[model samples]
Target chain A: MTTATDKSAANSETTAGQWIRMYRQMVSVRLFEEQVNELYTRALMPGLAHLYIGEEAVAVGVCETLRADDYITSTHRGHGHCLAKGASPDRMFAELLGKEAGYCKGKGGSMHIADPATGNLGANAIVAGSVGIATGAALSAKRLGKDNVAVCFFGEGALGQGVLYEVMNVASLWKLPVIYVCENNLYTEYTHFSETTAGDIPARAAAFGLQAESVDGQDVRAVYATAGRLIDRARREGGPSFLVCNTYRYTGHHVGDINREYYRSKEEEKHWKTERDPLKLLADWLVAQGLADSTQFKRIQSEVEAEMKKAVEFAVAAPYPSVSEAGEDVYA
Target chain B: MLETLTRELTFGQAVREALAEEMRRDPRVCIFGEDVAEAGTPFKVLSGLVEEFGTERVLDTPISEAGFTGIAVGAAMTGLRPIVDIMFGDFITLTMDQMVNQAAKVHYMSGGAWKVPMVMRTTLGATRRSGAQHSQSLHAWFSHVPGLKVVMPSTPYDAKGLLKTAIRDENPVVFFEDKMMYTKLKGPVPTEEYTIPFGVADVKRVGRDITLVATSSMVQVALGAADLLEETGMSAEVVDPRTMWPLDEKTLIESAKKTSRVIVIDEGYERYGVTAEIAAVIAEGAFYNLDAPVKRMGAMHIPIPFSPPLEDATVPTEKSVFEVARKLCGQA
Candidate 1:
């Protein structure tokens, strides 16, 4: 890996190793979801799981720029967040599989995998649920005089959530070290983003006095660059920033939502999957830059596949918490 | 007798004192909600907090209930303890995602890895003609959640003590105060610091003929009914389940056994509401001791009307409760 003298985002020096690692992380997330999908289809998993298949760059790119001590609050589609923010694959697998050793002791499952040690506050099923949580965490960091920032990850659908705006307003008002990252995947769920949302999102946050950035969410480098600048500025008490990443999801809203012919056309899905897949873009960019070849990419895929197999196996073998355990976590 | 040793304060003033005392005692504690900072809240429960703690600590948030509530959740999960004042109880519906999905479930979802030691204070009432949204007694909805604690303070003493306790509590606490009673529900609060623990029922008046279980503002109504009952042959015990979720089932059941009859009163709707829970508890625990069918008095299953007479007709009043008790005790 090549090093910049200042280790700053402004130092746009290319590093073969860093891109390769980022690609590997994205691939692992993809492979992990594929395994989950296969198991879910096979009735090996009981509950529904929201897959983070296509929006890989948004999580990997933004999270990679964050320090280990910085925090993130994720949405229901948060598997990629857990992977990118350093959650173990097997534990998350166990949780999604309803095993006790998993994050949240399998009590939370896919929609709620919190890794406090890594500052992942868990994924919320409610739209814009973590908007406040993330901002509050940033407020806490600022109050405690820590340099760490808290990022809130929500979809374009969350733009309709009033709380998102509320948190965004005071986040900038108090000059809280928070970042609002909206992965505008062009769809809230079955509906197109344009159908429900009006006005520019970044501009909306900017109106709240936030330093706003709009970027191509499919391009990992782009997300990384913008997030880097915003996060760095926030750490130095530059207040909050909002980054709207224009992206797309390859699959339906939830795993159970397979048939989308009613609200969406197959061509739109194909356009994104074939032309703008974050994984494919990253892989191609890496290969184009001579960072890794097809053979290296294949090798990474195989390794991730193996890891996913082991993780699924562990999840399958892990036992569910006893019925008595159900009553335990309700209080401190 | 114990009330005589305390200083008398308005319900709103008692709440203000609690916020001030808590903020003074712990730097981690801060207050936020709509108009809470400079205006001191619509009900003035947080009057002078901004002057005392400064605008930074006593925050006046953008009218975003979901945002501030979730931010409070995140802040509490981290190092800071936050008290979120929802301007009106009706506005709570806007922030249900944060309160129920994030604040209520974080500790449980995180497998006890974290705690949301936050307090959400709101005002609920009917006769003021605040319309449907501003006049809901939605405590039953919160009580349904497993991880969150629900507190309803009917008097100034309970307001001060319980707010202090809720602030110190390690779990998320939803504090519901009746707006109509903020100025009217005056009582003596100790000048010195004191706290009231949850799940404890306060037996406001002792009687033998019947147990009248009430919540929040309804405690005063039930007390009024009991006073009228005293003029007749019937003796009705007034029991205020100060906190319903951690409901003192023991006290309620004990009272049921003593009185051999129960009348549960709530300002919320009668269907599937707090009254239902109380009746179910008595049935489950004191079925053999019942002299008559346990009765419930709650708001009629209709949206709170804006007209004063119509609104009063929807909610439970002293006359309504007294009539029900009179009939149950064979005094009608």
Candidate 2:
């Protein structure tokens, strides 16, 4: 088992194109979340918004290794996972705005956005709720002789849930093709994780005989390298692995939760935002390596900003689902 | 009617036959749960399944109900149709978040993009001295959810037919089998294949004086009560709404209108149980034709005890149902 501070293996084989694409994806998620916070502040979005602003690298790096047909189950703070898994921004904004053109046709809203075309099982609102679904998908892949692997993305808060341990044990025993990705963003909604979680996190998976590893979540290359190794092993019948990504949440638990002095301090948030930001770290590496310049980074940001602006406009102009449709999809 | 050979089969055998036949027809169908493979689930309901389907399909998982149940949801959204075998209904509390928050809401929340074609098979009823932890008829809990279908079978024939439909359905269905009736109850099951559609009521016995609307284990008790009422120079109709969520409201209302009185019975708790929902539906649909207020019979509000006498006293019996029917008909 690897510790939280353990550095990931070397990523010398990754080409410039893949690195730039990963950078663009992370930037897309950040811009999308910035727009979501804008929607919430303007009272355009109906439900709560749990933005994935600071933890973009974990989703982008891990999902970058997956094929379009591979399955994934996400958590409540899941816009980043959805986008990284290939969900369209226009439809996602429509869903958050409770419009008929949304991913869930306005039924699921922020906490639940699922798409079969992209093999997203759906973003679950309950903590650690989708662990079993990801494991089951792996079981289906194995039994059906398909080489697809499933990725389950959850927060450290899910460690408090007993089902996570149960599934991890069974996944190890059955040798299912799945990965348990725990994004330890430190705070589990108003309290530090240490106050709630006891014992070592990686040791929990190791006890179940799973291949447990940890990586610096702010480093997209580290996340991509570690997740790629585990996912490939799983596809080749290596069973499940638990990957703990040490990340941070730059925003409050939700958009409405603005006060932060009660749980965390301004210095802590400032240090992570300025020094350890995922986008800034990746950009610095790209610049030093002579692979990209400041001009290319600026172009990427402007492109993403334009795309997000259009998506929000489409969502605001889209119609709400008719009252008759409220009872339509309840059965099949 | 099509000519088909019929033979008496126990409830357990019928359920096993349904699983075996479905797994054979669809290569994607599989079963997983604690002691499901070789142990055949303590009751020996699935004894020969592992031998036929092999261990790959008939998997034996850890005692992690929530974990495996969540996996079933994910697998169902993908390519495979999974049957999750929960040992007892009392343990459903562990899997509620996976079922309610994940499985039940996935399809509708995804805007009908994904389907959870899965079945959760578990046991209900008491009187085996299994104590409070092992005995419970909690089908009503699943039925209360919008996106889940709840099935309760009384006879071997109904069990086989309904279980087949549940496995083939394109949504999450909770199939509750009365454990006490596994071997004790026998009925003629057809050798040829067939499926009983949801939301259709079965008229177990036809009468004109009063109606006894029952579900699952209570259906058998209702039949016995109808027999007693026949001896007392009264006619009591018995109607079984096999699936509770997609309830046969039209059939139940028709029966209530014809009989002018009704007594709803189930094996779940009396307060806020299946009986209450069915009674409400009948009252709303047949208010003008009814002669008396609808009565409900179910398990006592306390936990089922370990003692045989106390356990038996908690649930409704043939005598109690008969007395209630008699009183409703103004003959008490």
**Alpha-carbon TM-score of each model against the true structure:** 0.92, 0.96
TM-score, candidate 2, is: 0.96
RMSD of 2: 3.2
lDDT of 2: 0.91
- Name the regions of candidate 2 deviating beyond 4 angstroms: A1-10, B1-3
For model 2, state the Cα shift of residue A244 in Å. 1.3
The models' CA-based lDDT, in order, is 0.87, 0.91
Query: lDDT by residue for model 2 over B216-241, one digit each (tens)?
Result: 88898999998999999999999999
Q: Estimate, for each residue in B9-46, the C-alpha lDDT of model 1 and write its tens digit.
A: 99989988888898999999988877888787767777
**In model 1, which regions exceed 4 Å deviation?**
A1-7, A10-14, A199-201, A252-299, B1-5, B129-133
In candidate 2 chain B, what residue range of length 10 has the lowest lDDT sum?
B70-79
Using DockQ, give the best candidate's number.
2
lDDT (tens digit, per residue) of candidate 2 on A1-332: 22211212327667787789989999999999999999999999987999999999999998888888789999999999999999999999999999999999999999999887788888988898888889888988887888888999999999999999888888898899999999999999999999999999999999999999999999999999999889888888989999999999999999998999999999999999999999999999999999999999999999999999999999999999999998888778
Q: List the residue pairs that clash in candidate 2.
A: A132-B70, A132-B71, A133-B70
Q: What is the interface RMSD of each candidate, in Å?
A: 1.0, 1.0
